[model samples]
Target: IVGIDAAIFMHPTTWKASGHVDNFNDPMIDNKDSKKRYRVDHLIEEYAAALSAEGKENEAAALLASMETLLAKDDFTGLKKMIDDNKMQCAVSHTCNWTEIRQFNLMFSTEFGTAVSSEEGNNIVYLRPETAQGIFVNFLNVQKTGRLKIPFGIAQIGKAFRNEIVARQFVFRMREFEQMEMQFFVRPGTQKEWYEKWKAKRMQWHESLGMPAAKYRFHDHVKLAHYADAACDIEYEFPIGFKELEGIHSRTDFDLQQHQQYSKKKMQYFDNDLNPETGKPYGNYIPYVIETSIGLDRMFLAVISQAYEEQDLSLPAGEAGTEEKKDSRVVLKLPPVLAPIKLAVLPLTKKDGLPAIAEEIIQACKPHFRCFYEEKDSIGKRYRRMDALGTPYCVTVDHQTKEDQT
Candidate 1:
């Protein structure tokens, strides 16, 4: 478990250094009929889902691939044509008419100080669109203060704000969200090896959570950002369909280089390790970064989706009564380590000092893990309640427990 770090609320120049002021944007389109704006990618994804639901899996797959190709090329006209050809309609208006796609900035900006001036030059500061810039700006301070060497990493988890034109799909996309990000600094030209290493390691970490491997896939970016040399997203199958859960990016010294130029600060790291190729110590150079960024909310949604299950627990015909009915339950089968309630202490009855015994158990286990105490209902009902909460273990206190301490 990593510790939470303070968020960075910095000058607008910091955002300009990070390129967020200019490059952080999404392609957006509006439905002419409904006058509703939609992110182009979301619109295509919805259309793809409709196709998949109609038993046109091949068509849906092809449509998604085409959309990706168009986006990679930044072919906005081709994208509009694809939408028209597919006859995709706006969900709200049920019409196919659409305006030309345009770029929409995602960063939230505000005036830095109370001023009567309407000028934006010195007054405007932006809520950081991402958390990595905070790490980048403080790289030297951390390296020098910690007496660090090359190949070290800095990790952070903090809130990021975005002015999303179309924020939907529950918490998957939000104006305010949390990001768990780590930036690993490595010597120049070693970035490729480290990138591959992190890609595999991150995938393994997800699998270690006991999630099905088939439920996750890596989507390589066809169109990389200005700062990225290599990048891919770990996509998970959510209730809304497959979507990006985390991103691994090979940012080749771009961030540090930009900060160096903008801040006029030295961002280079000196390496003492001998380079096998040159048979000499590697000299000072800006470290290339491998960034692993995950959306905490998206990860939570993925976990909950996998854990939720609907089960039928009806008895066999011979063991059932004449008026027997089918019984069903909705359960969250979360992993034991991830479950909110690890243990539940339920007394069979609230009387006869049973509640006291349960409370004792709660006090003991609460220090070790999360525990829930419930004694108001029947043992069977309490067990079901624990099941709904995804509690892995339940202990019952009864009359026999008072005698044998079992």
Candidate 2:
């Protein structure tokens, strides 16, 4: 619970320093039979999961292992061979005919000026693929201004853009999305410890919202990024399957180092504390970073998937008739803190000062939490409406309220 400063920045140079211009891409493959494109990794994962669900554990393991090996080696030919050997068919086409794999850049770029030209690399600027770079470039500004020390963090929530070749699965994968990220600056050689600490901390935060612990798990990356020394994902079991919901990476001064080199400016921090190895004060050096980046849109989807339910109400006892009515209603059992409507004030009847009393209660609770008022519908109907909206509490003002203080 450290105090951290938040900031937002947008600049073309930030992307250049972060290597998004050169390295932000996904392995894409086309289903020639269906004339459709799909991300290679996602397709493989889905297929493997289906095999596992169908009680083919050995086949699923082998397929996933082969896919991982080929991806690690960056062997596009080998990947295609694996697909062909397994007779993997596109979900849409139901055929094994596929085109060659290729790298597809995800960044969305546009011209900077009105002087439009069809030529490549003509004064181009890009929408940021991630929000971490903005925090990195503004490290010094925040540190100096906020008087922050080592182990401090910078956090932000903002929109990011990516030109996904095949954006599917609702809001889980989209051309534009929101990211909630925090970058912690810690002393070098202590990154491994901080990385583990944040990994556990973030997982706890997710589970605190009443989600079952079994629905979440840690997935360590077999292939690490060039800038990262260690990395893992907090994978959530969504309706489709387990997928990455957040990432925690231990970056060893990579971002600050790159920005220093490209901008020709020093991005070092001086620590007054004594270094154990040298038995002297820790001087100027670039601090290593531990980043925690989560997809805000994906988190929203996770909450909805868990909260939404279609419940069937059992018939009353002793009412054993063939024509007995069966009842059902949709409800959102959202966490109280995240629910849109916290409290609903309903008047049983619109006459005889009941509406006025309900309005008074609504005015009183509105300042404390979100409140909704309704008087047009039946009491049962109003309760059902509030239940659908995930309102945890409701107050009904009726004739009894005028007689008794309760």
Candidate 3:
């Protein structure tokens, strides 16, 4: 809702107020032999998976359950002992020699200027770990500028960075990634209602994208952030497994309140809308936020993983069923709206003015959406190629089209 790039480089204290300076950390362990650092949870998970693969299902489950208990309480000693006891080894080093688990801050910090020094701590700034803070800091700017009332949202898509100790499956957890976030501010007592509303709406959106509802489910948070009173993740069935694709949270005015205390600026909204209980204006107060955040890269992974398919288009046709079947075709049956290319215009032959007609079709479709034109391949080959590229449809221009311009 606000201008782009308006808050990329926020003041250093903005993060301090947002709790990133102290609270944004992941428990990490180092492999003494391999000299690699890994998030403690990830290390335990890998070891547990190995146990499962070895047919020690009960052991794996017990290990995972204990790991969660330790993680929830930030039990470093128990975490270390758990690893040592299980003989967990580094995948790289294949050795059990490991460093003690410690909290590692995920933010990537950098010197801000030529004159910046460690003594001048103000110069040390961090790349934002999340985009929600930007929206929170700019809360007043957007509300006043847009003349927005209560129960309005500020939407932003921006790049955020984190020094991930464990980067997992391709683009699943990256050091740098884009986030699509919306911070919906509402009357203080209305957060729970808005949280449930946005949760349903977001799940509906995922299903409308041609993915089956069975492939998605809600995962509630066991431990909430300091700022969040309620939170849950929308997990999608990815190729790797069911993982978080989006997060919905009820942040109960902690952000705006913190900013007000730190920045000495009032973030209160004088709501004129009457409350049903009091029949009076909600009056001046910090607005609670219901946030919906989706990782753009993770969404891409979800879409492509679900869309990709390999089909055997071959059929039994000859007598006695002795005929050879056609080779299987690989297609990305992407939803038409999400496909990179909407149509592929293929000329059946280079001669008989077929290529010219195909060119004409391309010109018309190109303005509306992406269109691919080619005359070098056979019609069947071109169709296969388009399917592989996730083009939703293909049109073959041939000699018969010249008869009546059809």
Please give the CA lDDT of all the candidate structures.
Answer: 0.88, 0.87, 0.87
Give one digit per residue, the lDDT tens place, for model 1 in 279-394: 99898899999999999999999998999988998876667966556888878899887898999988889799989999999998888998998877678877888888899899
lDDT tens digits by residue: candidate 2, 1-406: 1333333335667677787777777888988879989888878888888899899999899989888888878889998887788787898899988999998889998767677668867577777888888788879988889888898998888888899987889999999999989999999999999999999999989988877799999999887877899999999999988889999999889999999988888999988989888999999999999999999999999999998999988675558466556788989999887888899988889999999888889888889998999998699999999889999898999899989934
Q: For residue 325, what is the lDDT in candidate 3?
A: 69
* Model 3's TM-score against the true structure: 0.89
Count of clashing residue pairs in every prediction: 0, 0, 0
- Candidate 2 positional error at 69, Å: 2.8
RMSD values for the candidates in order, in angstroms, are 3.0, 3.1, 3.7
Overall local distance difference test of candidate 2: 0.87
Error at 257, model 3, angstroms = 0.5
Rank ordering of all candidates by TM-score, starting from the highest: 1, 2, 3
- State every prediction's TM-score relative to the real structure: 0.90, 0.90, 0.89
In model 1, the worst 10-residue window by lDDT is 1-10
The better-scoring model by TM-score among 1 and 3 is 1
Q: Lowest summed-lDDT stretch of 10 residues in model 2?
A: 1-10
Query: Which pairs clash (backbone N, Cα, C closer than 3 Å) in model 1?
Result: none
Model 3's alpha-carbon lDDT is 0.87
Candidate 3 C-alpha lDDT tens digits along 79-139: 9999898888888999999988888889998878887475857687888888888888888
Tell me the spans in candidate 3 whose CA falls farther than 4 Å from its real position.
Answer: 1-4, 116-120, 309-330, 355-368, 403-406
What's the alpha carbon RMSD for model 2? Answer: 3.1
